[model samples]
Target: MEISEIQHLAALARIRLTDEEAGAFAAECDSILAYVAQVKEISTGGSAAPSAGAHKNVLREDVETTEPEAYAEALLAAAPDRDGRYLRVKKILGETP
Candidate 1:
């Protein structure tokens, strides 16, 4: 990576870097890219480490249950806001309400 390339990348990432930092990062990025290129040259179409076996799925069967009314009421009482039986939480997306 050149200093200009590093400066461009820093700008795109919204990071502020001094001239010294940009120079240092340019060298580091160049070294990393060279190492990656070397690794790519040596890699074959097989895993470097041995695999134990094929992957297994261990999910349990889903079950449905209903809580008692008193239990549900206790939970609602601990919330910051609520509307009847539903919890009223702030919207995470779109414009604020």
Candidate 2:
């Protein structure tokens, strides 16, 4: 990267950088960009298959162990206020009964 390009990027990011800082960033960016290019070349040159003995699925199969409403009675028993089977919370908006 050139110093002018680095200065433009700093301006776009709303960052204030001195001439010395911009020069330093330009050199750093050049090295980083070269490393990325090398990585891209190596990745593109290889086969897309995984090596043997590697675990294909690291996660267990998803399974439901209980009925969906199994906890309803326990939750209703713990409520501070309830209207029959439903919880009764405070009315925070609009007109209240």
Candidate 3:
């Protein structure tokens, strides 16, 4: 990696690097690229398969239940403050009607 390349990368990443930092990064980048090049030189026999039992989706079926009254009752019961049949939460958005 060259200093110019490092500067270009820093600019693309929107980062500001000192001259010393850029030189250090250039050396580090060179080392990383060398390692990647070495990894590419490795040869695999082109056989890829699952070693253990096959994977299966463990998710439960989606079943929409209509129980608004029960859900509203549970929600109201959990509220710290409430009016006769509605929750009385603190005013969060500007002035209320």
Candidate 4:
């Protein structure tokens, strides 16, 4: 990477850099790009890559293990405020009439 390119990038990112900093960043960017090129070469030239179907989503069957509303009484009892079997919470989004 050139120092000019680094300076342009810094300008785009709303950053101010000295000439010394730009030169340092240019060297660092060149090193990173070289490393990425090497990785791309290795990935493309080698057969060590996994096959298309090598990965699959492993999920268990979604099924209920307990009866519905089994803990309703316990949950309502723990509520700070309740209307019979239902919990009463403060209205948060709308204006009051």
| Cα deviation of 24, candidate 3, in Å | 0.9
The whole-model lDDT of each prediction reads: 0.84, 0.87, 0.84, 0.86
Once fitted onto the true fold, the runs of candidate 1 whose alpha carbons sit more than 4 angstroms away are: 42-97
Put down candidate 3 lDDT per residue, 1-97, tens digits, no spaces: 8898899999999999998999999999898898889866777557954465687658866775775575877877888999978789787889767
lDDT by residue (1-97, candidate 4, tens digit) is: 8889999999999999999999999998898898878756554654566676878778978997679989878988998999998789998799869
Candidates in order: C-alpha RMSD to true structure: 8.1, 12.7, 11.4, 11.8
Ten-residue stretch with the least lDDT total in model 2: 41-50
Judging by TM-score against the true structure, name the best candidate. Answer: 3
Residue 51 displacement in candidate 1 (angstroms):
17
Reference-based lDDT, residue 92, model 1: 72
Name the lDDT of candidate 4: 0.86
TM-score of each: 0.41, 0.41, 0.42, 0.41
Query: Rank order by lDDT, top first?
Result: 2, 4, 1, 3
Q: 1 or 3, which is superior by TM-score?
A: 3
Better of 3 and 4 by lDDT: 4
